[model samples]
Target chain A: MSDLKIIKLVKNFVGMDRPAVNNVNLKINSGELVAFLGPSGCGKTTILKMITGLFAPDNGDIVLDNKSLLPIPTEKRGVVMVFQNYLLFPYMNVNENVGFALKMKGIDKNVIEKKVREMLDLVKLPDIGFRRPKQLSGGQQQRVALARALIASPRLLLLDEPLSNLDAHLRDEMRDLIVTIQKELNVTTIFVTHDQEEAVLLADKIALIFDGELQNYTSPKNYYEQPKNIKAAKFFGGVNFIKSKKINNEFISDIGKINYVGENINDLNDEINITVRPENIKLSKTNDFDHNSFKGNIKSIIFSGTHTRYKIIINNLELECSLQSLGIKNINQGDEIFVHLPKDKIWGMND
Target chain B: MGGERLKIILSLTPPLLIIITLFFGGIFYGFLQSLGYQPAIGKYDINFSAYYNVMFSERYSKLFWTGLGLNLWVSFASTFLAAVFALFGALAIRKTFFAKTVCNFIYSLNLPMPHLVVAVGMIFVFSQSGLLARFASQLGLINSPGDFPVLVRDKYGFGIILAYIWKEAAFFFIILMSVLQSLGENFEELAQSLGANRWQRFRYVILPLVMPNLFSASIIVFAFSFGAYEVPALLGVIYPQMLPVMAFEFFLNPDLNARSEGMALSIIIALIVMILVVFYFWLTQAKIRKD
Candidate 1:
């Protein structure tokens, strides 16, 4: 049980003055699933590759369990990576491909077949042993690749944007498959992805990286309720930023003076960006907002299946509010409404 | 008709014209002339003496075996050397920048240097009074320069095969390198990630990807070697003559009847290449079925 520890990791590509991954320190205990999340080119994949030894770090060390892995070659490193393309061996069928790693380890044919069969069953691909990768569907091939990686029972499992290759619907299915498989096997896992929803669904802890720097590493609920800075706040996508001045660590925006929401309430300051999630936003026709409420006109109303997604223009600021249509009438576009932003749910960040 | 619609005969005409002019016309004229219907010889009547001479004459029969046997050896030997060289060149370039640049320069240089120039240079170095022969005599490997059976115009055909490898290996190198390079990064990387060592990656991923390109390149280079003329004449004119040499000998003969024999030999060489191409296609089909 090698617990992966990456200390002061850095990777600078040739001819580029800037490092893609700079001074990153992260560790995963045995059986812990840690996810790296950010927008594209935030160096999440570079970090994962370095961990897998596909790319070497310019500076720092990777310590596994009780030993330092400086002398161990990549082939000896008992760490397997599952790429987004699945990288299935084109010439080998499911059984042969899945048993390749075991064969390389000098495992007997009888043992390899037994282990491969168990892995196939684990990834729900037991019936695909005789089929080539091209013959299987995208989802089925992903399962085979998972079986191939999992059968080796690697000490560390690195997944680089694995769900990004699938369609939107199938991406959701792969997400559950990855988290469930990782938990059941209890492999020390590191999943790198740009999808915030994926990070939220699969990670026990999410590290938000921006410009090759770690901004926040915390639980999903904490990340939503307490983003450390403006960059981390903007990446989650549907948050409304209301610019305001903080007096005595409370933001006074179009909504009103609001205090801290969930976690990191101690990090509030004089100038802030108040983030109100669409789910917490309330809209009414009266100007009865007290601590953190504002007068806003609904500029647009779009139906998003379960709720009405409203684009509200409050004075000079814009806000996104969602109203679940549970026997409620349709909120027409360009309707003047008073938006009530909850003081407790507002993550006021000092940019 | 739509503007994009293909003209049916336009695509058909070039190959059809090529087959008629290069194959049919040459065969028809050669066949008639070989039967001894030569206006130049003041005999407009057909006779089977040229074919009979080819079948019965002791000297012509010896020349035929020497040329045909040497032709097969030169073809297969050069193909083997070129395959090994191309594989090494491709593998060397895959890991280093300067090695790749140097190899690119060498292979590209080989493409434009004509075979006759290469053969002439080889003769300059391998002849009896040549630098290599002189050095070998001084080193006591041979008693004299003349004692070194000159590779040029020898029964062994060493110089001819060298020239063939020089030109055709570069051609195979370029195609095989691209095939070896474009074998996507993920398969090899994923195999390593799956605990395969470097040799395992080569055996499982690299070799399988490049084998098809190797087979195709072999056939192409073999054709180029078989149809060759200048190098074979320059290097092996004394003994074990190649098919092209035999054709040229008959073509330049003083007897008008022997000129017809040259055309028949030319047609035979062409048929050999044609049969090999057909056989190559059939073998690859069988391999695919076995897979």
Candidate 2:
């Protein structure tokens, strides 16, 4: 029963020059689900390990439940981890696996059985008590790992990409399952995942990390709308940008003069990297559209099920735009079209 | 799939043939000889006399049971000690590079030591006025070699157990290290995050998960030590006439009949180890359920 606080945690892998985790400090309040979202080798998993005391920090302290956890071993910290592989203890059956912590506590068998069954029911795997981990599907095994962690009534539950191993459809379902389950259990949890969408969908707070540094930690809305830096904007908005100069109150790039949207983050330093959204940059047959125009040759048009993305090379600048084409867009490759980009649709980063 | 199956069977043929010749053929021959229906002798005496003599001779009774008991005790005791050493060796290599390199080099040396060399090495290190006693005397820690104490050739099979542990622990360390490594860092992190203490994590996660391989390896080590001839003959002072030692002694007899009894004794020792292994399988299955 503790609120977890990490203060200036650093870990250096011996024999490796670069620090895997460099001076990471983050806090998870009680009953919150924060995600450590990063690509592989971003030190997200390593940070989780340090919190669980699986890896001792080369320096700094971890405070959990008003006590310094640096001196405490992992098992005594009251934090449970659900691994990416689900790690259900292959030699153990589901009941024993779920009730493992209680068994360690030397609890009565009857109570252990009761708690295990209750947890199994909570994970909606009520009939899987006698089955081994290998017998269960990836999703079901993930459920069991969750229940095992939750049944311990842990202070915090750390998930190291539990849904990554599942299939696409199953991954979606399990993401919802984890969120619903965490809300029901109200355990302060941090999920470590490389998948950006998984992090956005599952986390109340998304901490986007890159190269062992926290890029931005914010809610999903702010993360997309107002990115802190170029890395944040690039990852969250999925935008395409071109280096440009801010002269005559417009972005002069290879494409054309993109109308400068200066209402937000127009703080021009010396140079500007402006992003033209693929969706916002439109292509139409009308030559008279009152917008910055470029005569683009239709290079290619990819027809997705519900939408089409057009690749246009205008003035030797390849510009891509997504169209919500519902089965019809009288557009073909090698056709001439006018590309219209509104002033407000352009986002620029001061470099 | 069919071609793969064929390839697997074809690959297995050589090992299957070796198993048939070395294991089954030996067992079949022993069975025939023990029954006293020796085709080579041109005799088919339907009598339990050889069995009775092998089973109930006063020397056989005294030597076989005592040696069997001693072998069992030493094998188990040594395996336990080896397991402890392997655990320490594993933990030592868990995080530190220096400890890892030295421990690994020393432990890996165990498997490479031949029985002859191991026995000779034991003589050089553990015998009376050997390297240990010589060093102790020079250090002025002991008055004489007798005061240096009986480590090797000790009456309680302490010497055999020590040598067995020294050799087997290193050999088993490699196996144990692989098992621990294969489980990887994630599972331990999972256990700790689940609020499992170091002991609890080890007991609940690490031990339970790897127990299957560990138990199997332990039994293999057990059987190896039980039937081993060189170590017991050379270093075993607690029971000079240990089962394998007694078997060697009987086999060296001038009378051909005495050698046949020795084979029968060998057959009995093999059966006991096989039964013990079967029991181990049963025990492990139950443990798997509990896990």
Best by lDDT: 1
DockQ of candidate 1, scored on C-alphas against the true complex (2 decimals): 0.60
Q: Write the per-residue lDDT of candidate 1 for residues B186-244, one digit (tens) a residue.
A: 78888888888999888887777787889888998888788788998898866667988
The DockQ figures for the candidates are: 0.60, 0.55
Clashes of 2: 9
User: Share of real contacts kept by model 1?
Assistant: 0.77
Deviation in Å, model 2, residue A208 alpha carbon: 2.0
Identify the leading candidate in terms of DockQ.
Answer: 1
Error of 2 at B104 (Å): 3.0
- The residue ranges of model 1 lying beyond 4 angstroms of the native Cα positions read A244-246, A249-255, A286-290, A313-315, A329-337, B1-19, B28-67, B95-99, B126-128, B131-154, B256-268, B287-291
Clashing pairs in 2: A2-A65, A75-B195, A75-B196, A75-B197, A79-B193, A80-B193, A80-B194, A92-B291, B155-B238
RMSD per candidate (Å) reads 4.1, 4.4
Most accurate candidate by TM-score: 1
| Local accuracy of candidate 1 as per-residue lDDT tens digits, A70-180 | 567677888899888888887788999899899988999999999999989888877889887778989888888888888888999888888888898888887898889
